[model samples]
Target: MVYTKNKNKNLIGDKVKYARLKNKPKITQNDLLARLAVRGITLEKTAISKIESKTRPVTDKELVAIADALGVSILWLLGRE
Candidate 1:
């Protein structure tokens, strides 16, 4: 068995945080969690915080859900836009 550690835990963490805070109403961590839940992606408040803090790795499913919840594109979240 082999494992590779990514240089960065997640590429979209900062962007996710940015998009969330950049919202007109500034979505809080809890709000983001709720949004994700509405999208059928359940995550804890701490998980959201970790994601935003770049300390957690987001799954592809989570990436899509988060992007949708934040009303942003995956490309944008990946810093491609």
Candidate 2:
């Protein structure tokens, strides 16, 4: 099996952290987890922290869920905005 590593640690980690902190009420990591859960995406708190710290790689599904949860576009998250 060939395993391909990501060129970037994560494309959206910084944006995720920014969106979470920039919300009107400032969404917590736990709150973002709950929102993702509501959308059928399960993730642990540490995972959220890792994602924000750019120590984790995010899947496409997670990206969509995260964008929805943070009320941001995937494009923006990917820094295309």
Best candidate according to lDDT: 2
lDDT per model vs. reference: 0.89, 0.91
Structural similarity to truth (TM-score) of each candidate: 0.87, 0.88
The alpha-carbon lDDT assigned to residue 78 of candidate 2 equals: 96
RMSD of 1: 3.5
lDDT of 2 by residue, 1-81 (tens): 676885556978889999999888999999999999999999877999999888889999999999998888999999998
- The residue pairs that clash in candidate 2, if any, are none
CA displacement after TM-score superposition, residue 4 of candidate 2 (Å): 14
Q: On a 0 to 100 scale, what is the lDDT of residue 50 in model 2?
A: 91
| Model 1 lDDT tens row, 1-81 | 576886668889889888988899999999999988988899876998888778889999999999999999999999887
Judged by TM-score, which candidate is best?
2
Clashes of each: 0, 0
**Model 2 ranges with Cα > 4 A deviation:** 1-8
lDDT comparing candidate 1 with the true structure: 0.89
> For all the candidates, what are their Cα RMSDs to the real structure?
3.5, 4.0
Off by over 4 Å in 1: 1-7
